[model samples]
Target: MTVIRCPGLLNCDVVEVPHGLRLLAADGRSYLLRGLSADRLAEGPLPAPLAHALDRLGLLRAGPTRTVAVVGSGRLAIDVAEALRGVPGTVVAELSDDPATERPGGSWQLMEDHSPSRLTPDLVVICPTDPLGLRPVLQLCRERRVPAMMAWCGPASAWSGPVLTESRPGCQNCLDMAMARRDPLWLATAAGLTGAASCWAGRSWIAGQVAGLVAAGCDEAAWAQPTWASWTPRGHSSAPLDPHPECWWCCQSGPAPVRAESECSAVSSSAA
Candidate 1:
């Protein structure tokens, strides 16, 4: 099997310490290479044992650079962008609803339009502070067949999950359907909500989780699963987001025919 240094480790600074080589990773972690030389590792023909060890440690693998679009506003979005910036081989872009507003000192460029046609990204990470703001973006992802992952904060909790994709069994609509089945009034209640929820305490933690998910999604062999996770004051819980049998999004023939915004809203309102 062909082995190469993990794309994530590409940005590490290789230092020749007295004892051996110390690789300083962007995340502030260091790896000590005892007998191996950086040049040899980079050049080729690594020993089988060494290659296996590095692969196990996630320091060696084959992966291409991925363009990831993060859509949303507020601290969580910024936090997710900041975390993704440290991940090598991942180009991060911020898609904002507001064209005039730009984040100061942000490393990534601000995309004025959230349209997938404008910037076709390998994946989209959505972590808006307000859950209700997700509808339009979810609709866009559905219409464009763009894969998306969502992370958000609730009044007293934080959530990351249900990575949506055209190839996946569950989409955001299925999630809404699942929610409606559990709580018949969920859509109505969600419609009434206004401002974003505050997740001051767990913003960074949830952002890290989302960033990690983005990284995993970039690997061809590590396709993200439609799983949902929630962090509450009480504890953490996670489960698979299965496709709803009656979901119009994934259960239909091809892709759900692009519907008008008002028509989509009517369907959701009726589902509730």
Candidate 2:
């Protein structure tokens, strides 16, 4: 019933459980606030990439809109949604009380459940597979046949999971595989820190990375972006487990495994 607005942003500002959204204007820019705490609102002057991403999303638009929902409603999601709000469309975010509980212990096991039936988004941005989350997302992308991007950087082994790196000149997979694999402890360390303090400071960087990947896919879906072609493996067929016609992963198919520039053209961008 109560509508509060700010700067050039549209949102509900009533702090406690936000009766509505508010938009605020500040030094030549607008911002939106909703079901958020003062601390998050104050974590201002967001990263440039993220701010650019927000501006692109139209953080100042008002009215109903079609939206692609982000699965994890973390601080990144909050910021992303705010940017989306400015757009002429909605950015529906699905939040759950417990994320860890729903996710699988093993990343692979978790991917098994990455089915479309489990979601209802025009486009879904699964958290990226960093040293922390990639294994599962990789497996899930294969199982769900969902296209995902590498959000977090990790051991080459993490990168080696199943996405498409080509072998035209050579197999980056084999190259990555030859490198020392990361210990589980490393995985934990990469995703470590799970509360507020980290969210405002460190986590945003990682989240911004993931957010960019997600938003890219969303934009591609919304606007038929051209599919970059490939000479070796076809796009989306980049999974390590995927049967490349001449993949070294399955067989020593190619001659001494030529090194392809890790462009991963095979893993074409397809967001849904």
TM-score of each: 0.67, 0.34
lDDT score, candidate 2, position 120: 34
Q: Relative to the true structure, how large is the alpha-carbon lDDT of every model?
A: 0.63, 0.35
Q: What is the lDDT of residue 24 in candidate 1?
A: 62
Once fitted onto the true fold, the runs of candidate 2 whose alpha carbons sit more than 4 angstroms away are 1-67, 73-90, 95-123, 128-130, 150-199, 205-272
lDDT of 2 by residue, 116-159 (tens): 55543344343332333323333343335344333222222112
Cα lDDT of candidate 2 equals: 0.35
lDDT of 1 by residue, 1-272 (tens): 22233323344466766656676655677788788665665655344334445545555445467888887767788778877766545687887644464654332232324665466677788766555455666667656666777777766777776767766577666666676678767656665544646666667667767666664555433554677778877877788888777777776766555666543455464432
Residue 105 displacement (Å), model 1: 12
Model 1 whole-model lDDT (C-alpha atoms): 0.63
After aligning candidate 2 to the native by TM-score, how far in Å is the CA of 71 from where it should be? 3.5
Clashes of each: 0, 32
